[model samples]
Target: MNCLLTGSSGIVGSHIMFEWIYKALVEKTVNHLFVVIRNNKKPAKDRLLAILNDSSRPHFLNDFSMADCLSKITVIPSDLSNIKKQTLEKYNFSTVIHCAGSTSLQHTTDSKEKVQHQNFNVTKQLLTELPHNVKRFLYISTAYSFGIQKDKVTDTIANFKVQEFRNPYEKSKYESEKYVSETCAKKNIISQILRPSIICGRLIDAPFFETPKFDVFYAWAIFLNKYARKASSDFRIWIDQKSGLNIVPVDFVAKAVLHAFLQPNIKELNIVNPTQILHKNYVGDVLRYFKINAFNYVSERPENLNNFEQLYYKTIGVVFEKYISVPDLQFQSETILKFINQLNLSTNLGVHENFMKLIDFSVKKEFKSSYA
Candidate 1:
């Protein structure tokens, strides 16, 4: 089987590539792996090699020589914003894994246009470019696309109009999901949409600084830690203290995607952890991790925050308020869980371990200085 994958340089896409290439190494089920990447300065092969050689990869690949694995793949360099269909006419692929999309939550004019083009427009264009022989189209989406609906998040497409989205990113994913489903149906294509919520880092040698487009959870944790350090008195960040966040690690997400890709029919799957991270525990753990006792989580916004605290929330918190203020929602995980069970895979759904790993990586990288 031949495959075409986009966003091979991204967080989730990198993980997917790692796993897919590993499978090829073992069983050789995939005949050819074509990676679609966008980099003007560096060649596509160099970018793929970089991801494979990164020290932060899953621990299982530490002993394997990446050179052998990297040689088995092909890379195509293109922005994909307005890719012509004729450009891909020569290659035949059985699967197309679409993982390229903007994850910025910023609300600026530039951000609005980026989210629209990257998420919605890109998917629309790719659907037209897909070969007629392609059997599977896997699209990576976020469970938050359900938006601010503090209710049950099922394994299905969300209604973009009825729900109130937290930001343009969520809104864009919702719109893109609609387009993907409609186009695939009309073309008689098999499409699977997988929604993973709040993706975190792996425990084994996870990268310190992720691409800014992704890694919102880590960014939030690091920002809060910085704010705590600069505050004179105890400070509280406003959030629904009781809300729960479904923070799943990348290894789990990658395995889930791999399993979903093999299945004959899976319309939609919520690739989320059954366990969730409560807001109080998250803040409490973060404070404890930093060895600081000056921070807390509060339901209401503090009135008299200091200059630094004011700036922190006004800049970081306000941009992420929609995510932090969200109430806990139930995620339907029957299909995904069944798939994992059938594969006999053990998944670590603990939030504390993953959170601490991220904190450690951030500290080692001195993200406080770099990001600040």
Candidate 2:
């Protein structure tokens, strides 16, 4: 199978590429793996070479050690924003995995135009203009695309009006998904969309510093530790006790995507999230893991607290306010579990282990001098 994979430098993309080239499509089935990268980014040759030379360097290096696999992979430089129709005609892509999109939650309507351009417009162009030989166009979308309904969110795609989005990123992705579905219907192209919730760490290595969602928790922990040390009194970050946070590791996400695509008749599948802990539970677990006693409050109590407690509450409040507003963010895991059971791929998704590893990695980096 000749495949076209985009977003090779991204966290999800890098993981997907590693799985597809090195593990799943190894040896015979994959004749050529064309990696579509933006020209302005790191040169594809250099990126691939870096991976090949050292797979343990913390970047997208795990797949690099597979030199035999890399030989079959070809890097194609093309901007998804302005990919020429003629250029796509050059290669016969049996499968096109679109993983490129801005995952930023802070983008405004005007500020997010470029992201929308890349996510929606570019995808529209690719599906509409691509050669007829393309069999499947797989899009990597976010679970948040289900919108901030706060109620039960099913794995099935439901129609959400444009104005209902919680943030510009969500709105843009929804718009892009709409366009892809519409265009695919018109073009008669087979397409599948995979919506993954907040992807955490890999069991083996870090994906990238720039695309750090799972790593942010570690950073937050470090920041809190530093703040605690710097502060004159007892320190704690306050969080709501009722809200839940959905976090899935990168390994499960990659495996699910691959499994969904490789399955005989399956068109779409939402990877069942194994760890959907309540926000307070999540924070409490991390704090407990680190031996930090966090004072949890059921109601807003900023007025009674002293300066240090007030500041810490304010800091955590911001993050809570942003994410807590997301509707129906709690994902259904039965589908993902069914698929995993059916495939009998390694039963250990390692969600907690991977998260703990991330924390360990950060703690080591933060206190290397003192520990050494």
Candidate 3:
């Protein structure tokens, strides 16, 4: 059977592509691979080559050549929602891995519309346009799609209202999940929605690339690092210290995705780190890493701050404060844990040494400069 994988250029998708390629190289379960990438200045094949050559993916390049891998894969350049029926017929895919989606946190009209279109519309179109041979559909969604709910988020479709979303991205993904659930049931498709929490950089350093990094918290931290001169040590950002952040390294997430994909019976999975870090501690670690001043956790925003302090708060707080202010969420991971145990995968939660390695990886890659 062949596989159709989308978002081959993204962090999670690229890692997934690498894992699948490695699996294909060894097991040969997948006969052909169709990678769907967005139209850009660079060709899809060129982009895939860059990913294969990316320093973070050295494991994939250990024993293979670009020519050898490309022989088994077809890079399709087009909007995912616009994939033609003829192309689907030609590929006759059995496994469809839908990892492409808009991930903007901005709430502007255009941004919201784009998020909805890319996340929701693309899923609808793919479900409708895919051929009958397609058996498995794996969707990459965020655990934050649980929204501002109180209960623990389990391996089930969250029943969240539109207003509960922190931003358009979450709302769009929630809507897309609902649509995928309904469509899969109606069309008798075996679907798996994988909700990963706060995917960050790997624990290994890599070469610098001009591409944008997908980690939002790290991006904000890097921004602060670049503009460290703009604000003084007195500047403080308030947050709830008790709230927990369920974060996972990108490499771990990739392994979880593949393992969950091979599981016997699964409808939904929460690919999250078992040991969650406190939001306040996470922020403190970042600030200390950047040599910034200390910050105290408060229930509400503090008053009487300097102009630069206010600007700093507004700049980073607007997009990320919701995470720090919300109540802690419990992301159930029984299914993924089972798979990890069965596969004997590394369940290394990013803490202490791993955390430092992750941040250092970003530093080596100069994420601060590019993001700032």
**Best of the two (2, 3) by TM-score:** 3
Candidate 3 global TM-score: 0.90
RMSD of each: 3.3, 5.0, 3.1
- Candidates' C-alpha lDDT: 0.73, 0.62, 0.72
Clashes of each: 0, 5, 0
By lDDT, the candidates rank as 1, 3, 2
What TM-score do all the candidates reach, one by one? 0.89, 0.80, 0.90
Task: Please identify model 1 stretches exceeding 4 Å from their true place.
Answer: 62-64, 158-162, 204-214, 340-348, 367-372
Per-residue lDDT of 54 in model 2: 34
Total clashes, candidate 2? 5
TM-score of 2: 0.80
How many pairs in model 3 have backbone atoms within 3 A of each other, for residues 3 or more apart or on separate chains, i.e. clashes? 0
Worst 10 residues of 1 by lDDT: 204-213
- Better model by lDDT: candidate 2 vs candidate 3: 3
Q: Would you give me the overall lDDT of model 3?
A: 0.72
| C-alpha positional error of residue 90 in candidate 3 after TM-score superposition, expressed in Å | 1.4
lDDT of 1 by residue, 1-372 (tens): 778888777778888887787777776765677888777667766777777766556656665776767766777777777776676666767788899898888888899999999999989988987767776788999887787664566786543233677788888998888788888889888888989888766632344323213367667666756665666767677888767678777766777887777774777888887667777767667766765577777777788887766877788877767666657666767776776576565443545555666666665656532110
